[model samples]
Target: MAAPVCLEYRIEGNDFMVAGAASNNIKNTLKMLGISSSVCTRVAIIAYEAEINLVIHGGGGVLKAEITEDRVKLTAEDEGPGIADIEKAMTEGFSTATEYAREMGFGAGMGLPNIKKNSDEFNIESEVGKGTRLYSTVFFNKQ
Candidate 1:
């Protein structure tokens, strides 16, 4: 594609029923664009994890995907209380998810790690009281 294609979605906190909608839509869009299955899967995982983060910890936020000829960039931004320690948050088993979220089978402390695993490049920034922003890129031809 010569011009980039962008998809954006507003996610609501604690909205379990629609939590995966944005990620599923992003995946389907990539598939329809003839992207490879592997790339699509990676992007889907990144998007899904990010989406869940928005719902469980973000208190509502925006999820965006920018598609280009060579890569897909996914971003999740939220205005909720941000992480005090990014390093700890990135650990596989560390989570700030509430008891309700765990009971609902949503939070397993693997969201950020999974997103990073499937992304070719990933970065996250946050302030304790301000918010969080996540940026991830998946190259179309990368394994």
Candidate 2:
């Protein structure tokens, strides 16, 4: 595609039923545009994890995907109780997910790690009371 394509979704906190919708939509968009399967899978994982983070931790937020010829950028922004320690939050198996969320099989503490793993570039900024924002990029040509 010559022009960039942008997709955005509003994710609600504790909304289990609609948690995966935004990620799926982003993946489908990549596929429809003939993006490579590997890239699509990576982007899908990033999007899904970010979406879940929004629902389980962010107290609702916005998830966005920007597709360009060379890369896809994903952003998850939330005005929820933000992370106090980004480093700890990024640790695998460390989570603040509610008991209800755990019962629903939603929180395993892998969200940030997984997103980072699949992203060509990843960044996160959060404030204790303000909110959190995550940026992840997946390159289309990375083999």
lDDT of each: 0.93, 0.93
How many clashing residue pairs are found in candidate 1? 0
Residue 117 lDDT in candidate 2 = 95
lDDT of 1 by residue, 23-106 (tens): 999999999988999999999999999999999999989999999998999999999999999999999999878899999897
Error of 1 at 140 (Å): 1.3
How do the residues 1-143 of candidate 2 rate in per-residue lDDT, one tens digit apiece? 78899999999998998889999999999999999999999999999999999999999999999998899999999999999999999999999999999999977989899999999999999998999999999886632
Candidate 2 residue 73 Cα shift, in angstroms, is 0.3
Off by over 4 Å in 2: none
TM-score of each: 0.96, 0.97
